[model samples]
Target: MTFQDYFPIWNKLQTDQQDRIRSNLNFRTVKKGTILHNGDMDCTGLLLVKAGQLRAYILSDEGREITIYRLFDRDLCLFSASCIMRSIQFEVTIQAEKDTDLWVIPAEVYQDIMETSAPVANYTNELMASRFSEVMWLMEQVMWKSLDKRVAAFLLEEASIEGSSVLKITHEAIANHLGTHREVITRMLRYFQSEGMVRLSRGMVRLLDEDRLRQLQD
Candidate 1:
């Protein structure tokens, strides 16, 4: 769905309010594999993903990439609450997973909207709460769950959002998301494929036996 379509809060805006937003919003197109912003950079604005997928991650001192979250179409991205409260730089790097179209709302404009529009403020609160919930859930899973369980959870999340069983994703990306090594992801994927739970190719994975995959998690 388009940004304006999925973001139902926007529909509640008055014409003048919409005009104000349009005035500050900027649209841009990015090719696949583009890094939109890096961790520890100055917070500039909210990135609204209109189309395509984007991944955000943190790099550890040991240079390991830990996937924090993914921003798909209709998602609004902002600096983490910790970063914003402390006036620190961003905590994650954002990268486009495919050719992407985006609408950027400057920080000042976003703040103004939040102050002036109840709908916009409510939207922001809901988005932040969701992000916080996901973060907590991921932390719990990483600490208590098996790798297979983690993979199953990730696949289910992706499939739920994409509305499809086939996922066009890379092994390295999955590894980063799981905070593991690429070799480990490759091996796990092979095992899953051999078990007829999934089909893997160069850059795509298809869930062939989702029931079996879930059972593996169990």
Candidate 2:
């Protein structure tokens, strides 16, 4: 799909505006685990995921990383163009979780359009609100949800996304996603194994009782 197809407000934009956007777009294919944008330092522009997965995360003072959200096919990530949103103070890092094909619009060009185009500006604001809501939900989960429940919920979610009960993920990776320690995740997995919820071997975790995991998460 072209930039016009990926942008939600393409029809709302004028011919000149559309032309500008098409001209400024940068298309790239990145390998898995590639860092597209590193925190607040790079205004990598608005990212439109044509295919594959991307993760938006933040790093703590102690160097731990926690994912804010994941972007999949057809998702528009406004936070990548963070330079345009002066009010957003925190830094966010964008990384490809799988081989990805994406389009990036230069921050200045998008900001310029947002300034002159009501449809673009409104869309941008609404998108930012949605992203913030996701972040707020994550914060609530961290604060109120127990680690066991969180772990179970994360497992269920991963299973759903991957479409398999057998997950090829390591305890360290799971810990990074949950903002916890590897030892903690290992212990939790061991407990789950004992309860017949899962069977773990090396970096693989196979679900034995997904219904129990769902109930536990609730």
Candidate 3:
């Protein structure tokens, strides 16, 4: 993809500034299972995924890996905006779940891009705002909704994200994402499977009847 395709703000930059950013951007391909960044590591440049998938998670105090989010093709791998702005260490780990192409742009340079490119700045602001809204919504869900409802919502969201009814995930991973026990998740999955909402196969869960799942949530 051209720099403009990835960086819409490229247009806002002067010819020279745009050239500099293009020159500075470094591209790398991370293989599946590669650990891109770790918690407590220095938060550096922005990572733009050109292709493939990534999972971002935080280490709980009890040594659990609590997945915070997932990143797909063309998505930005963000950890802490505050840390990036302050140029400090990050508190999340980012791992490539599939072979991924990524563009790395230094944090300082991104700040410059935002400063010079109104379009790029606006895009960044929108990204942060959407993330904030999602977190707030998740917080409310965890506080007010039942675990069953949360699981249903999460499954639906994940299905939408993957753009398919079949979920290629393991029970342990689901438990990690939900901050719950694996057995609990397994039992819940069995219940859903029995209810004909999902079909559990070897290492995957296929959402069979979404309407039923939504009804259960209600």
Candidate 4:
């Protein structure tokens, strides 16, 4: 498939507009752990994932990391082209969470097209709004939800994403996602084990009671 196949408004674009985007599109493959965009310093173009996963996160002054949102197959990430969005003030880092295939549309080229195309501008604004909504939801989760509930929710979300009860993720990784510490996650996992909610082994956490975990998350 091509970018047109994944982009919803591709057919609405004029021939020249389509040609300009096609000419500037870049196909890329990245390995897991590769940092594609480094905060606000690198204005890496808009990324459209063809396969695998990408994680968008922000780091605090003290170096703590919290995930803002994740991009899966067919997902379009607009924040990578932060320079195009003048309203975006904070820095965000994007990394490959798995071996990934994607296409990047050059920011300058896309911005130029947006200036002449109302449809493209509208689509870009909608995408930006959706990303901000996800960030707002994460803030609410962190503010009002307890650690145990957050952990349970994360585990369940991971299970659904990976299509399994056993999650191959480390305590430190979970802490990084939730913006907490390794020791705190370890303590919470031990408590979950005591309650027979999960079974931990080395770098894995296997869900034992899905119903109980869902209840706790609620």
Each model's RMSD to truth, in Å?
Answer: 3.3, 0.8, 2.7, 0.7
Candidate 4 per-residue lDDT over residues 137-174, each given as its tens digit:
99999999999999999999999999999999999999
Candidate models: Cα lDDT each: 0.78, 0.93, 0.77, 0.94
True-vs-predicted CA distance for residue 11, candidate 4, Å: 0.3
Local error of candidate 2 at residue 137 (angstroms): 0.4
Off by over 4 Å in 4: none
Q: Indicate whether candidate 2 or candidate 3 has the larger TM-score.
A: 2
Q: TM-scores for all candidates?
A: 0.80, 0.98, 0.84, 0.98
For candidate 2, which ten residues in a row score worst on lDDT?
Answer: 1-10
Model 3 segments more than 4 A misplaced: 80-82, 87-90, 115-122
Error of 2 at 159 (Å): 0.8
After TM-score superposition, what is the CA distance of residue 184 in candidate 4 from its true location, in Å? Answer: 0.5
- Give the per-residue lDDT digits (tens) of candidate 3, residues 20-129: 77888889998988887766545546788788888877776787776667787777755633345544333777888788988887777777767877777788878877
| Pairs in clash, predicted candidate 1 | none
Displacement of residue 189 (Cα, Å) in model 3 is 0.6
lDDT of 4 at 209: 99
Candidate 1 residue-wise lDDT, 62-144, digit = tens: 88888778888787787522334344443777888778998877777667677788998887778778877877877888899
- Please tell me which model should have the higher TM-score, number 2 or number 4: 4
